[model samples]
Target: MNSNKKIIITAIDQRSTVAIVFQTITIGLIMIGSAVGNIGILLAIYKTKSLQNKTSIFVANLAVADLLAGLLIMPFMFICSIIGDWPFEDASCNLTGTFALILGAAGMNTLGAIAYERYCAIVHSMVYHLKITNRLILIVITFIWLEGLVLSLCPILGWSEYIYYTNEYLCTVNWAHDVSFTYTIMVVMYFLPLGVMIFCYASIFKVARRHLRQLAMLDTLSPPSSHNQIVSDSDTQPRIENSARSLRLKRDIKAASMLFIVIGTFVLCWTLHGCTMMCLALGDTCPVDFPEYVYTMTTWIAMFNSVCNVWIYGMMNRQFRDAFRSLCCIACLRSSNTQVIQI
Candidate 1:
């Protein structure tokens, strides 16, 4: 064979192998993590009637968006990666691609809303009316979805251009490599929400610390056991203290801790991918050998954040942990019953 033919064969062989491996790893991780997390959250809410409060409702909304993103986007991406181009017909392409983009955008926005809500619950508890009506939450959720739809559908409507990186065949907002577009999106999607999250969570932590300090102070001030004390007042104070402590722990876990982890993971994964795209657009001459693979991997990493959120919840929130344990027990019972029948 000629040298040209030999090099051509070698390149195709290499690219094909890399594509297969990347697709498999991305698909496996996203699918298993998302499915398990979604099931756990759903079962947790259903079994624990108490978990259906305002906070869990917001979480449920976020989970629904992430669940859809995982189920729709990752499979579509996996097929595209393996086929080396758009696999769907033009109509299917438009629908699937648009749906994926919309849900992905909505997921981010929902996370921002959750962050803001947590901020309010922690920092401004006196003003927080748990009377957040169903109508209000529904309106908020609908607005979030609509905002995402508008942004994602702009290219389809000709307000923007949809371009795929030739190397990876993944589509995104090309914006003609303009920093303006990238910066605008970064602000809208990342910077603004991240700022809100950081500020709110910091406030939450401060509030918790202050509350704890006050409790410790009161404990110290209370008279010794020998002192005459109103029995009911004494009993009530301990109950109040215990309840306050429980709340501080819960808020600290959900708002001040777990939420930061989610934001951190998201910023880490998407920021790199976004910066690389910006660099390539600005004529940085990205290395061709593995740029696409790196980009694809990082993109999946961002998506994986969605998958990990439920586990974060399970780890941080007592209610989520209890719900997850219950789910596992139920699964174990079903498996044992199946074996008994087979016997």
Candidate 2:
């Protein structure tokens, strides 16, 4: 009996050690990836002049938010995860919690803004350039950051509160502190932005489909010899202009599709965390017991979304992919040159 008990205890200890090591490695990778990926995005946008456009401005803002979260929030959480406790003071906890909230709110708001931008560019192409000027885009981004700052400050201002959870080993807004505050965050941060993204994407999709159908109808009605026939200069000019417009429309649709994927991934990664928080805020009315690890895992999952956006851009956008490739090649050449000089 004594031998069996000793074996059981030893096995449990080994398992715990393995779990810790795995978690540390996973979190460390996420932190490094998030930082590197977001930085790469900002660099690509800066170095590639073609990428410096109205849409790129919003992309850069999102990158800044994710980059800050990766640097400020993830590093502390990584250390605490390794230490298995919050080793910092209460003030540090509050700071991290507030930053976490601010970055998250900023990211969601930026996504909503991007969706609206795409909607206008595609659905209202005639007025898009006149209405969505660079100056206006800058103002919109400024508003997004300010909105995030004000909402995040609410907890610090005593509307709710930030507290360190021992089980989670990180500081965040206390969902149970005030149900009303929790609901407010849900409405402002999650639901409102999500609604905007959904509505915009839906409208964009409808326009794209209508364009496709019209093109198909035109093809069906046109004479088969139209492609080969010589035409007058007057007719040729109009055809050229129409062709240019169609190409631009196609490009816009492709970009919108990629952004829709990003939004979908964000929803997938955050839904569980959002639902869990709502339940916690409900308290007795919810009456569901959640394991401490669940909280930790859900938060980590949401944080991982920051790491995904850059990858999605690199994979889906040709311009981004080319820029990334060029950057990587330059980096490799620099490393080789340095090694040769050292030798």
Candidate 3:
């Protein structure tokens, strides 16, 4: 009996050690990936003049929020996961929670803004340039940040409480303590923006498909001219203009599709985490008891969305891809110059 007890204790100890190591490695990877990817996005937008458009502005704002999450929140999470508890004082925990909330809200709102921008560009092409000015976009982004700050501060102002959960091993709003706050955030920050994105993207695609069908009909109806036929400059000019418009429309649709992918990924990454938190807030009324690790895992999955956006941009946007390549080349040259100077 003594030998059996000793063996069980040793096995449990080994399992705990393994879990710690795994958590540390996973968190560390997420931190590094998010930091590096978001930084690359910022640099790509800054260095490439072609990418400095209204949509890019919203993308840059999102990158900034994600960057902060990577640089601040993830490292703290890594430490806490490794130690198996929140090591910081109460004040520090509150700050971390507020920062996380701000970033989360800001990022989601930025995505909604991007979707709206695309919607106008495609559906209201005639007035898009006149209405969606840089000044207006800047004002919208300012409001997004302000709203995030105000909502995030509610907990500190006594509306709710930020506390560390032992199971999750990180500091955040105590959902079970204030179910109202949890529900509010879920409905306002997550679902509202999610609904906006869905509507905007859906409308944008509907317009795109209609335009494509029209273009196809035009192509089919137009008569093919013989090689010997003489074409007037006025006749040729209208065709050229129509062709240009068609190309621009296609490009806009493609860009919207890429952004839709980013929004879809966000929904997939966060929905599970949001549902789990809501369930926890429901307390005894909830049918299922989620494992402690489920919370931690879902949280990590949601945070990983920050890192995924950078890759998606690189792969989908030609301007971003070119900008990333240029940046990499510059960095390599600088590194070589440094080595030469040392030699």
Write one digit per residue (lDDT tens) for candidate 2, span 109-194: 89888888988988898999998998999898898889878978998788988876655556778888788889888988888889
> lDDT tens digits, residues 199-230, model 1?
77778778777877766776666534445755
| Ranking, TM-score, top scorer first | 3, 2, 1
Question: What overall lDDT goes with each candidate model?
Answer: 0.67, 0.80, 0.81
Query: Cα lDDT for residue 264, model 2?
Result: 90
Residue 229 miss distance in model 2 (angstroms): 5.5
Model 3, global lDDT: 0.81
Q: Which candidate is the best by lDDT?
A: 3
**Model 3, range 1-343, lDDT digits (tens) per residue?**
1211111101222238888899889989989998988999999999999998888899899899999999879888998777765667667888888998999999888888888888888889899999899889989999999998998899889888787765555677878777788888998789988988988888888887887887777666554457998877865765676697699778868966886897789888899889778776787787888876787788899889888877876668888989989999999999999999999
Candidate 1 TM-score over all chains jointly? 0.82
In terms of TM-score, the best-performing candidate is 3
Model 1: lDDT equals: 0.67
Model 3 bad stretches (over 4 Å):
1-15, 226-229, 232-238
